[model samples]
Structures are given as structure tokens and as C-alpha cells.
Target: MSNTKLVINYHITEKCNYDCQFCFAKWENPNEIHAKRGLSEQLIDQLASYYIGSGLQSTKVRLNFAGGEPLMLGKRFIEIVSYAKQQGFELSLITNGHYLTTQFIEQHSHYFSIIGISYDSQDLNTQRKIGRIDRKNNQLTPTELARRIKLIRHISPNTEIKVNTVVNALNWQENFTPLLDVITPKKWKVLKVLPVKNDLLTISNQQFEHFVMAHQSIAAMSAEDNDSMTQSYLMINPQGLFYQNQIHGSDYLYSPPIIEHGVEHCLSQIEFDLNKFANRYIKTINNSHFLTTNTNIEVNHV
Candidate 1:
């Protein structure tokens, strides 16, 4: 268990395509996110050092890039990915797959051990209802979802694919019958829609589990119920502030920015459970097909 690597859910940017109404990083206006976006190479270095230096000595740190959309940062996102890999860290990325291009995949596909794309439901109407539409000029089509999945697998062949389905009222009842049966992912993360303030999209334990069971046979499943989500990850918002989304009071606890408080201080502020962090990687890393050269990455299943 001491050897299990830490997984950091790093939100690289607030600017996202398809503004989900139940967005955890509830920006007041989605349009203003671009103006608010910033992720310096300096902060990126600090983040890498914190996890790499302070984490288990034998294990390589896994930085999972997420966002309003990490791909929205475009080339800069890849720059950060390169920097982290150079520092002896494993990589993962979460995107809606809207910006996956031939050039982008060819250049940056090797950096990530896993590339996750969010897919809430099989029904197009349900997707629209859950705020999975491009709030800007782009239209969200029914076929676009399937197209993006196939394109990603075609372009980036070796890297492990992971699908994130946030179980909510819109998607819970619908059958998830393996949307990507052709391009099977290494893991299917079935996460419950977190209860936030003024939140309407919610799911019960029964509902969340049912969704996971439906898709569990399709791939390795990481089913995080509300209780399972808390302290299971080391999460960094776009501002470089580390936060924990819990199943308790306020639903979240935040730390000072890694720039201001430093990584150790920021981690201490959150009371992060190292045990939980180790446990999370146990289920997902086995079948990752992760092609990193680093020998330090020990997949501890204990």
C-alpha cells in the first residue's frame, strides 16, 4: 500500500465546451472563463515538485489533467504535460474530446497513460438536458459524441482510454450499453453527480450503482459513490489551489494556492488521506496499457 502511486486530479483551466448545468466549478458566466484562465509554467513546476518530492519515494506521481477543458488551453496544455513528464511523473488527461485533432494526438498522445472523455448518457436528448451542449457557437449533434470517441482511438492507438460518466437524474435511468463497444476503454469511471449548493441534478446510491453495473462488464469500472469520492483524490482547481470534494458539510474543502502556500502547506490544509489516495489507483492502473518509460511506476493493488 505504501507503494501505490498518488493520482492528482488537476484542473488545468476553467474554460470548457458543453457547460454542464451541474458543473462543479460553477463559473458565474461560462463566457468569462477564457478571460479568467491562466496556468503558468512556474505553477506547473511547483505542482510537479510537490507531488514528486513528497509522495512515496518509489512511485511516480500521476497528474490527471482536467478542466473547464484542459484541451481548451491548447498548446500550452501540452507544454505543461511535457514539463511534468520530464520531472518523472506519469500523466492522465480528461477532456470532452471536442478538440482532439490529428496533429494534437500525434504530438502529445504518448505523454498520457490514460486519456479520459466525459460521456454522460447514450441518448442525445439527455446529453442536451444535462448541459452537455457547446454554450458558444458550436452545435452539439447526436452523432458528434460517437464520432469523437472513434477519432480519438484511431489517432492515439497505444494509450489507454477511460470514459467518465457522471451519474445524474438525466443519465441514471438510461441504459449505458457500452457506447464505445468498438473502442473499448481500459476503465469506465461512474461518478455520482455531486450535491452542490442550488444543485438540481442528483442521484441515489441505488441509481448510481445501477449505472455502474450496466457498464461494469464493458470495462474495468471505478465506481465512486458520494462517500467513495471524498479524499480519494488530490484535486487542484485551475487557480493552483488544491481542493477536496467531500460527501459532507459544504461539499468541498479548499486549500491555499500552491503558489502562495507551497505544496506541503496546501496538502496539510486539506487533511488529505494518503491511504485513500493509494487505494484509488489499485483498481484502475492494472489494465491501463500505460506506455510510460518510467520504471518507478509500481501499480500497487494492495
Candidate 2:
């Protein structure tokens, strides 16, 4: 009944390759059993089944690969993407761009319509120095990271390659300009860092202030550079997490909380009257912020 299509963010791997202090995932390796461990094929199959059964066949869907680092579950992810394409759906991935390899990209190029790679120069040294706890032996560097982005562009030039960065205290002012210099030619995207509890991505209040200022500055300059493009965008964390959005009155879809209910349930349940998705966004924001603020207040009082 709704003309709006759903962009489903499939959180395949909660395990990341880098232990960046700013990472919000808090992706500690529990190393649990099959169901409890990393993203399992079972979860993928369940998601695929849910999509098919929901009669949301008319829904133009894009399966966004979210992660600790999606490539950590490389082969499995490729298989899922392949399955989705076979069933007539679009697939995309968001990565840290560290584990990228020529062979892997070549193999999976047909699977994904787009690939988003994240990099933050402020956390550059940290990523270089340490390995993600899940992948303890692996470490990534800026040059290597840059090389991956270039290679993705070169190999899969047709594939939409987006460099995604979280603008916060460290890079917002001092280093962002240089980062823009490198990425803007590639037409990369810079996103605002949304607040998350116990998130490594959390910057101080001062850093956040600079981030907004830098964002406004970039928006003004970008208007002159390309009026056709909207550089900043919002993404829903798969658990249906709320992040910041400039368009308060717009629809921002999220997965229904009940995994068994599927997409049709979500569509039917959402009351998109005059306010559209604004109602849902406000509700989520209020709940999440309340919890976050109370937790912080409790911590401070203690």
C-alpha cells in the first residue's frame, strides 16, 4: 500500500577488524556458540525467508551489509548477496576498507551495487597500531586504507564506491579539510557522528560543537561546488537504532523489533499520517536520549 521502499540494513557481523576508540559497535568478541557467536548462515536464511514470506515483493529493497567489519565474514556475505540478487533484490556493503583484496572484490563485484568504506584520520593511528579484538592479528594503516579505496574504484569503477566518515572532535576541524581534499574528488560522503552509549565514537561536547560548525561550513561550500548532490545522509543501525537526521519531517524506516514479524508487519504497523516518519523518529529519539541521559546522570551522581 505504501509507495515507499524499504532499505534493510542487515547486521551480518558484529565482529570488527579494528579497535578504534571511536567505534560505537563496542564489538567485543564473546566467541559464543553457533547461534550466539558471529553472524550465522541461519540468521541470513531466516532474514531471506522473512523477506520472501512478507509479500513485500513489490518493495524495492537494498540489503545493507553492516558490521563489526562485514569482510570478517567475507565468504558468507558474498553468498547472501548472491542469493538476494538471484531473488531480485539489490545488495550493498559498508566496510572499514582494510580487508579488501583484488580477488575478493572481483568475485563479489557483481553481488553488490555499492560499497561504503569508513575511515577517520583522527582514529587513523589507533587503527594502525591495534587489531580488532575479534581479529586480533590483523592491523590496518592509512596508506593501506587509502590504497583499498583506490583499488575498489579502479576494479569496480561501475560499482558505487562511497567513503563514509564520522565527523567528530578529532577530524571535524583540524584534519577534515585534508580528508575532503582526498575524498571529494571521489565524491565521498561525510556523515555526522550520532550519539551512542559506551560508544568509542563519542567525542567530547567541545568536539561535537566543532563538528556542527564544520558541517555547516562544508554545506555552504558544497552548495557552490555541486548543487545537485546532498553530501550528508542518515543510516538506521539494524537493531533499528536512532541517529541524527536533519530532515525531521521525513520518513526514516527501520526494521521491526520482532525478527519473526518480517517487513510487511513493519510497513503495516507504521502510521505515516501527515507527520510521516517524524512520529517514529521523535519517539525513538526521545526514548534513546532519555535512557542515555539518565544513565549518564546516574553515573555522575554516583
Candidate 3:
């Protein structure tokens, strides 16, 4: 039996309205790639069938929508979610929250189990250095961001909220606690900044150290409070076009997996060993050589 949970992360379109400096998706001249609007209902059905036929039929496979901004796909997202539910799959979507409006939230709140929003501040000096937010389109203020988050909660109380923050040289240490103050006591999650090689932004050893320290600190807080209300989640680029692990690296530099026979063709190749992966990604950074050498953790090779 394939015990691995099937998480399908789809990049609907590469075009983004905002030109955030540090956008991992690395939207290069958004004009180059025509924003492919909602996928035809037919392709949606085919995708559904492919997943179901590949033993994802009964599993609580997650459907995640990502992109320049997934919500930008508009009605296609709703259609896909409806179809996924009809097949009994859970749903999730990651967005910049720049396009998030009350009307958009109201229309699709019930369909998703969670909605992830990415926000970095408007301080141009801070934004330009890290390249996380578009200089021009980085219009949403922190107050506006807080308001949008509030509306999402009000519209869909059950839908968990996750905030993806990329910790870089400038804000990794100083801004973390402040960002936490904003997220805690609410449903939110923060992702450590992972680098994509050759992208406009690269992660150096120093930045990595700061990020690891921040993660360790937050992880400890989450442990002590019990009600820490913070969690870490993964969004793998099925195509491997982004990060080696979607959540860790830069979108511009990473290569998404090639889906030839189907999506599982790529999924089956992954070790699917969460512990080992964590040891490699999370532990290796801490310079804790113990876990690195302790390969005794048993996992099915195949």
C-alpha cells in the first residue's frame, strides 16, 4: 500500500499582477507569459480522473492552487474546488492576499480547508533589499493586510489561515518577533526563507543561520505555549520548477518536476521519508551532526 499522502499543487498561471521584488515564483516580465485564465472544465475533469485512478480515489489527497496568484485564475478556482469536493478531496490554496477582497472570500470560503497569504512590509528599503514584495504593486499596507486576514476569518471561521513570511538578511532576526505578535492568537503559520539558486535573491550562510535560529526559537515557543497556534506546512512544486522542496527554495531558480505519465510519476520518486527530509533540511542547518549520522531510522526503500 502506498502510505504517502498525495498532495497535488497546481500552478494555474505564471502571470502576476504585482511585481514583488522577492517573489519566489520569479515572474519575469509578467507580460511574457499570457495569464492563462481558468482551465477549461474538461482539463479539470481529466486532472480529477487522473488523480482518482492513481489510487488517490479514497485518500484525503490535498488540492493546492498556487501561482503568480492562484486567485487571479478567478472562477476556474471555484470550479476546480467544486469538482475536487465532488471527488471527496480536501482543498487548499496559496495566495499573495493582494488580490483578496471581501467578495472573493465570501464566494469561496466554504470550499477550502485553508487559505495561505504571503505578506511583506512596504518599507522599500527593506523590500528592495530582500526582493519579497513588488516595489510598484506592493500596495497593500500592513493595516490593510490585517483587515484582509480578519475578513477571511469572518467569512470562513473553519478555514485555517497560514501566513508565509520569507525571513531574509534584513528582517530574519529583528522583524520575526514583531511579525509573530501580529500572527499569534490567530490562525497563522510562518515559513522560513529558503533560497532558489541563480535567482535575483540568494541565501548565504549567514542568512541561513539567522533563519535557522528564528525557526528554532519559534518552534520552542510553539512547544511551551501549547496554544502557540503556530505550524509549519509544505507546498511542493509538483513540477519541481520552484524549490527542491517547494517551501524551501526560490521559484525563479528551482526546476519543477516533469509530469510525463502523470503527477505520481514524480511523487513516486520522492523518498517520502518526512523524518529523513527534516533531518536533511532542518537539522543539517543547525550543524547537529548526530541526526545526520543516525541513519537508523527505518523507512521503506521503495
Candidate 4:
């Protein structure tokens, strides 16, 4: 656990162009903090002060911006991540890749240590069924995805690329090896779709395992079943509150706003298992080919 980095997944906005059925970025609060720059900066300062400035010598903090689509925030998203970088926090972003333009990548890719794109299925019909298509029915094809990855790699060679796939009833049997071989992501995070809103897209445990086993040859591949996902992450919702998913329920438990109640008090309100968090990322840190030369290792990230 000594080498484990503290990851803070800050879901800056719940608004998304594509409405995936299994999407879990629902906070229901219309008053999101990202719209209020002052409040958002205040929250970031609190996080920086406690996690980085508070003399936690053993821990390095990574601020990962996530959302229904963080890229939808456009320039404001870049502004927030830039501020985080300025504060000496390692940064990352998880987006659906619809708005990841080449120009943006060329200019702002340097702000992140990593950029994770959600790519569920290679088949267009499956992607459409999963609601991963945008308003114009435009889906991010594998060719375009690979192009974006190449651009990111060329623009900022040090910025690691990651692909996140949610194994659902629609895409569980699809093999991603062909596309993954082309992009060669630093990591391919395969996750079981949590029935947070509905079980319509959820897949069976056996089906999930089948997908992981099928992709065993990918050196950067990792899988996280629902059990390993629970209480294994430190997440902040769009409202600047600490939130955690219940192991058995669709509902999420949340703390009071971090802007209102400080980081220490707010963290105490949530159920964050340090051991689970460590176990979740330690394996990733160990098996990551981006961090090491070992290509035979496989791990999980919650």
C-alpha cells in the first residue's frame, strides 16, 4: 500500500449528451458545483490542502475528473483540470470521447497524467442499444477512437491512455482485443455494469467472467466485478459532496457538501474502507505496464 496513490474521482457534472441506461452519474441535484467556479475552486483547495498540503508524505493524490461526460463542459473542464495541475495534483479525466477533439488534445493533453475513454462495444448496433450514441445518432467508431488515441500519444507522449468498458447484457460477449491491439491503451478497465438505476443492462457474473477470460491475452487488461467495486473508491458527486455506493442497493450514500463541511468532517460521514481502496489500486499499480515492463500481469481497479 505504500506505493498506492490516493485517487479522487470528482464527477464534475451529471449532464451528458449520451444517456446510457447503466450510467451511474446521477446526483439529482440541479445545483452542481461546476457551474459555480468559486465554489468549485474552494472545494479543490480544500482537497489540495488536506490531501497534498497536510504532510501525507506517503500518499500522492490523483484527481480524476469524471462525469456523465466531463468533456461536455468544454473549456471550463480544461480550466478546472489546469487549476488542479497548478495546485500540484496529478490529474486525469474519464470521458465518453464524443467531444475529445484533436485541437483540444494537442493543447490540453499535457494537463493530465492519464486520459480514460469509455468505449463499450465495437459494433454500432450494440452501441446504439446501449445508448452510447449522441443526439445525432453519431457513435464513436473504433477507427475514430484509435485516431484520437494516436493524436493524444503524439501530442503528449507522457500522458497515458486508458479505455473503460462496461460489460453489460449488450456487449458482454463482444471481443475487444482487435481494437485494443490497435490503440494499445496503458490500461483497459473492464467493469461489470452496476444496476444503479436499472438492471436492464446488467450482465450475469458468469457472463462478466467470460468476457474477462476471453481477453486474457491483453497485457493491460483489468476487470472489476460488483463486489470489488463497493467501498473501494473515494468519489465526489457534482454537488461537491462525498458519496459511496451501497454494496447491495442502487441508492448512494452521500456526505454534506465539502464546501460547507470541510474535507475531514465530510470524509468521516462516508464509508470509505482504506484497506479496500488500497487492495483495489495496489494491484493496478503493480500490474500496470505503463508503470512497469511486466506485460504478463493482470489486475483490477474499482
Candidate 5:
């Protein structure tokens, strides 16, 4: 790991308000660690002690709070990130933007280095078809999303904004240039839908390429296909265990709970390719120059 930051994507909860058909946050256990406050804090403490306290001055740990929807945790989510920040870890959050209310951004935006919102389509019908809407038929329209981004910029100017778009059959042909221009995010990640749960929404590599080509003019854009996605991320599930997607199928290979077996022991049970991770990290840094501000950290898995 060439002085790259360790991005531990902790899927704190499997519960989400939206019913996105392509969502891959599913795990075996419905009981997520977030429900158990003490256990959740314990996991955070262990991660901080091992990664931040390991005396590796060359690596910076970015604890990205992901979820079925992290913002749904509301005040509890704020407390978790606050604790992680105190432990010397850089914080980021990937939310669906449904619960990314003005109150939260105005009050807690300072807690994050980056805030990623999943915005797949600008068309309300497309969004509804993709299950990106809540039970009440509520969705984050482009106007609303742009409004939120403006608020973030005004309140937390230093905090980088990110937009995550999953390229699936439903929205691959749609042009996002107008939307991207309006939001003006620091980074716009276009990810090919993975077939972890089902291939119903998966698009061909060629189709995915078309979407990327159409938006090639976007300066802050990056695209990731399935091949580049697998075995590259350091993921921890809601059960407090290190896990990776199986190379061959939809199945996942999990380690013993990190809280119980220790980080080293748990990591040993999974196959994490350092080379792949380095490539992804380097690409991310290249795409977003703002990440270079803090680069003196040691190598640790996220």
C-alpha cells in the first residue's frame, strides 16, 4: 500500500427505507450492531486502537459509514461519527440522501470529510422503477438534491461532496450531465450495478461503457465495472465482522467477528488483495485531488 488511506466501509445497518432492487448491503444477520450501542462503540474503539494506534504514521484511516441508509440512524449516527472522529479517524458517510435533512447538514456536516449521496436518475419514474423511492412515493428529486448540495457547500465548504450513481439497465442510457452540472460535486462515481443479489438490473459492460463515454466531459467522474469492484474494498458488515464478496458468486466470505477474534485474526480469514486496493486508492486520489491533503499514514485494511 503506497501511503494510501485505509477506507473501512462499515455497513452499520442493513435496514433502509428505500427498496432499491440492486442494493447489495444485505448480510446474513438482520440484527445489525448499530442496535447494540455498546457493541457498536466497542467495534469502533477496537478499530481505532488497532489501525490508528498501531504506530503506522504513513496511513490515514477513513471510516466511511455506509448502510442500507446511514443517515436513518439520525442522532445515534451523529454520536457514532463523533466518537470515531475523537479516535483520530477521518470520517465520511455514504447515504441515500433521503434523510440528509437540512438540520443534519447544518449541525453535523463538520463531522465529515466527505458526504456521498446516491443519486441514480433524475427522472422520478426511473427512480421509482429502481426502487429508489420510499413507501410514500417520496424521492430525492434533482432540484431537492441540488438544494441540499448548495446547503452543504454554504455550511461546510471544506467538506467534499460526492455523488454516487449506479449504472443499471434502468438508467444507463440517461444523460446525467445536466444533473452533475447542477450539483457540482467534488466527485461523481458511476458504478456498474453488481449482480450480488440478482442480475435483473445488471447492464452489459458495453452498455456501461456507453454511459461513461457519454459523460466523459465531466471532470470529476470515475467509473467502476464489476471486475474492478470485487476484492478491492475493505468492508465490515453490521455483525462486526470483516467480509469480502466471493470472487466467483454472490456469496460472501466472512471472518470471525472482529470484536471477538481480534482484527488480525479476522482479517486472516478473508482474501484482501493489496494490489487491487492500491489501484483503487490511487485512482480515487487521482480523480479527487483534495484527498492528498492528508497522506502520512501507514497501511491498514478498511
Candidate 6:
């Protein structure tokens, strides 16, 4: 409900290097989840025009590229970001840090205002226990993650690097002191592990809070509990269709994936809580509000 503009969380790809245990995008055929496939240039253009018409006075829109490792698209991702820029939108991206090459870092660093690295633990044993290993030969250790953080800072001094940690049963009790001390990010977001269709690892509120409080001094920490987590974000699945995640029976329930249905129609079916979305962010980023009437419609942009 930011009066400034809209924020679009788009899952751009489905090919991921690391097989994290609790990955939400546990699709049957991940390789099929390419952004270009579902979101055609025509669709993107229509979306751009719709958003522009909707928010005439709004200054900018934030397009957040997420994944199954969004970087799998490589230069294509940069191309899309450039296209979005041409359409008058700011950009941000989330990555697993596996494909953070020096060349790519130097080339597309300025395309994103913020880049988030998904790092759960600093302990190798914990990482292994949680399936954070490369199916191929090379495994990404915590030291390597730290090294990448430093590399990002050294290369792109202006880009804000945020460390996104999911508090789960595997490493919630472990000390995060050493990791935080090594390479601190601009914003440290501690999100409670959300249950998807198949989540084997999870944690309680007490455990998550304990870990967050452990390293508050490391950076400006913002902790989101399950309830807030559900309502806070506008998440689009790999098929270019937005989804609202919540408990159904034993598994999770996701709304249907259809971009042509429009974001507003799908959002209304899910009864998305706009109030939570409006005030969810607690970082230093300047976030303001839109009138509730405008927000009630939410958005029809894909």
C-alpha cells in the first residue's frame, strides 16, 4: 500500500544450483519454470502499461526478481531489468550466491538497488544436514559465502547487500555470532521458516526469536513471525502467476496460477490482508502508504 508505487515479487526462473532442504519451490519439473516462457514480452508490456495507468502520480515501482536462483537466466535477467528500467521501474533481486561471478558482479551490479543472499547457517555440518549442497562436484561452504559478501562490498560499494536467513529447526539454536561478525549486510532479515507443500524442517517462535536476539548487533535485524510472513509479501510463483500461501489440510494451499486472470481477481479470492502488506517492512528504506480505497483494489498487474 505504498503510495509511492507498487512492489512486484516475480519468480523469474526455476533452475537452482543448491538443493536446500526446505526450498518452497519444490516443483515437479523446475527447469520448466523459466520467466520468459510464462511472461511474454507482450504480457510484460501490458503489465507495464497497466501499472503506469494505475499509479499515474506514483514516482516508481520496485520489481523484485526471485528464483529457484533467478541468476540462471544470466544475461537475460539483466536484459529484463534493462527492459523494466525502460518501462520506468526500479529493480532488486534475490539470489543463492552460487552464480555471483566477478564478471557478472561488475557488469550488472548497478541494475539492482538491493541484492539479497539466502544464507541459512555458517556451519558446514549444519548446511550438509539441511541439504545445502551442490548436486554436482563443488559445494558452497560458509566461508565461501562470507567471501562472496566481502567481494560484493569491494566491487559494488553503493549496492546494498541484504542477508536473508530463514530460522528453522536445523540451525536455530546455533550461534550466528561468527558469521555476522565476518561480513555484515545492510539489512539482516530473519524470517521464520514458512511451511510449503513439503517442509521437513521447521522451528518454533521461541527458537526463531532466540537466534535473532543472538546477533542483533551484527546489523539492523527485522524479524517476521509466521502470521506476518504470510500477510507481508506479494509472491509470484514460477509460472508468472501470483500466489498466497496458507495452510490447507496437511499441506499448503496456493491459489491458481493465471496471469490473464489479473492480480486483483486472484488476490480477492485469497482475501490478502493489505494492512499487513503496507507496514510489513521495518528497514531504513523509506516506505509510505497509499489510500485504503486504492489499495482495496490492490493491483491488477502481473
> In candidate 1, residue 233 scores what lDDT?
74
TM-score of each: 0.82, 0.61, 0.65, 0.93, 0.92, 0.83
The lowest-lDDT stretch of 10 consecutive residues in candidate 3 is 222-231
Model 2: lDDT equals 0.49
Candidate 2 per-residue lDDT, tens place, 23-107, comes to 5554244541223433333444444565554665535556677767777765656665666576556788888776678787766
- Residue 148 of model 4, lDDT score: 93
Q: What lDDT would each prediction earn against the true structure?
A: 0.68, 0.49, 0.51, 0.85, 0.84, 0.67
Which of 3 and 4 is the better model by lDDT? 4
> Which stretches of model 1 miss by more than 4 angstroms?
27-39, 53-58, 136-147, 283-302
Cα RMSD for candidates in order: 6.9, 10.5, 8.1, 4.2, 6.0, 6.7
Cα displacement (angstroms), candidate 2, residue 176, comes to 2.7
Clashing pairs in 2: 22-200, 22-201
Question: Residue 160 of model 5: what lDDT?
Answer: 97
**Model 4 TM-score relative to the real fold:** 0.93
lDDT of 3 at 231: 17
- Model 6 misplaced stretches (Cα beyond 4 Å): 3-5, 29-38, 56-59, 247-259, 282-302
Scanning candidate 2 in windows of ten residues, the lowest lDDT window is 222-231
- Model 2 clash count equals 2
Which digits, one per residue and each the tens of the lDDT, describe model 3 over residues 188-256? Answer: 343334444344443454453444444453432211110111111233332332223333332322333
Best by TM-score: 4
Alpha carbon deviation, residue 159, candidate 3 (Å): 0.7
- The candidate that wins on lDDT is 4
In candidate 2, how many Å is residue 103 off? Answer: 1.7
List candidate 4 stretches off by more than 4 Å: 57-59, 283-302
Please provide, for model 6 over 1-302, each residue's C-alpha lDDT reduced to its tens digit, 9 standing for 90 to 100: 44534567877766788777788775554433344443544435545665664764244667788878888787677777778777766778899788888788878877788889888887778877777767774656778887777777777788888878888988888777677667777767777787775557887666766675565555446666677666557666666556667635334345554456664565566646666766554223443221112123211100
Q: Write the per-residue lDDT of candidate 4 for residues 1-302, one digit (tens) a residue.
A: 56789899999999899989889897778998889867888899999999888886434889999998988888788888878888889999999999889888988888899999999999999999999998899899999999999999999999999999999999988989899899999888888898886788887777777787788788888677787788999999999999999977789999998988899999999899888777666543446321111234333322
